[model samples]
Target: MESFSGPDATTSDDGPPPPSPRARSAEARRDAILTAAATAFVEHGYGATSVDDIAERLGVSKPTLYYHVGGKQELLGASFTLALDAYSDAVEDEAVSGVTGRERLHQVVQKYVEITTTVHGRCLHRVPDVELTPEVRDRLRAVKRKVDARIRDLLREGVRDGSLRSADIRMSTFAISGAMNSIAQWYAPSGKLSPEEIAERLWDSFAEGLRPR
Candidate 1:
């Protein structure tokens, strides 16, 4: 028996090769498109922004943009999702740490401050829920509920440890969240304060007020 052999053919035992550069390139392109969408939504209000606007910013066609993230709706959803996921990660990490409740609150608020200055973070803070589709809005509501519960638990622990004065958990949640949410409103890159400085200042204000007498 003879095995067929061509002049340029050799039998090799190597399996499939690693992912091609093209695959990596596509991933990068998708990320770029998403970033551009975030920027557009920030510059112009989300209601005023369109898929064509995003595509224009990227120098890409509407269909090309769609190929990456489906459409404007999904792009907006992804931005909010990214912001919330970072916040969730920060909260989860600090929740189990042995630090006192006051310190834990500082870390959580600082994370929010850092995220609030970014484009996606700003979008999440500034955009109203009415701007989102029914589905994404509902999903975001559920995520927010979970995050709020963690905050309330942290506040209760702080009060128990006598590190913080007595306060309503629900009220504290609104106050802390409102302060963080307002960052995107007044913060600017050219401002005198850096994000760290701003975060420190904001946390100090809350901490001073909460300190036990």
Candidate 2:
């Protein structure tokens, strides 16, 4: 089976000092803040959710919050980053290390589904141009476009191997993406379905239609 390494562990640590006890605490706090912020962003519109709202959610003072992410825009941007990282972690995985295009793409869909259902995924999808600074908006768009490209590339690879049907790559992407993104709108954690089950079901449904006729 193929294995993928994340950016942090993918490299050997250089000469940097081990994080101090304070640094570790700070890191943990930052993660907590980001998680809280992402949840707030998903629950409330990015424009409507204030820094104070996130601080309140985490039960931290504004100064403590600022120490982690600085402000709302940064928090919003970081939430998007969290989503992107999830994508890379999933799509980049070895996926039983399949060599065929369809095999690999199925794994991508599965992982993407699993990732999207989480807090990070919703944050990734929910951010909007109206709420973000122009620069941040553009940055998030770039990240999203890159994700789209990754999907297209996998599809094209599949087609080349005769494992996938030939289709309009761009429209195909929109169709698949629209279906996947809708998961966030209606999914419930309390529902009987688990993330793995949902991802597998989605892959089964999508794979049948996506194959060459």
TM-score to native of every candidate shown: 0.84, 0.82
Tens-digit per-residue lDDT, 33-143, candidate 1: 878888887778888999988888889899898777787778988888888787677778534465678878777788778988988888877678787888778877876
Which pairs of residues have clashing backbones in candidate 2?
A: none
At residue 22, what lDDT does model 2 achieve? 62
Error of 2 at 22 (Å): 1.9
CA deviation > 4 Å runs, candidate 1: 1-20, 93-98
TM-score of 1: 0.84
**Model 2 off-target regions past 4 Å?**
1-18, 88-96
The total number of steric clashes, by the backbone 3 Å criterion, in model 2 comes to 0
What are the candidates' C-alpha RMSDs? 7.4, 6.6
lDDT values, one for every candidate: 0.80, 0.77
Give the clashing pairs for model 1: none
Highest lDDT model number: 1
Predicted candidate 2 versus true structure: per-residue lDDT over 1-213, tens digit per residue: 112334433334566455555657777788898999988988887878888898888887998877777788888777777777677566554542588778887877887888888887877776665666677677767766766787888889889998998568888888777888888876766889988998888888778888788
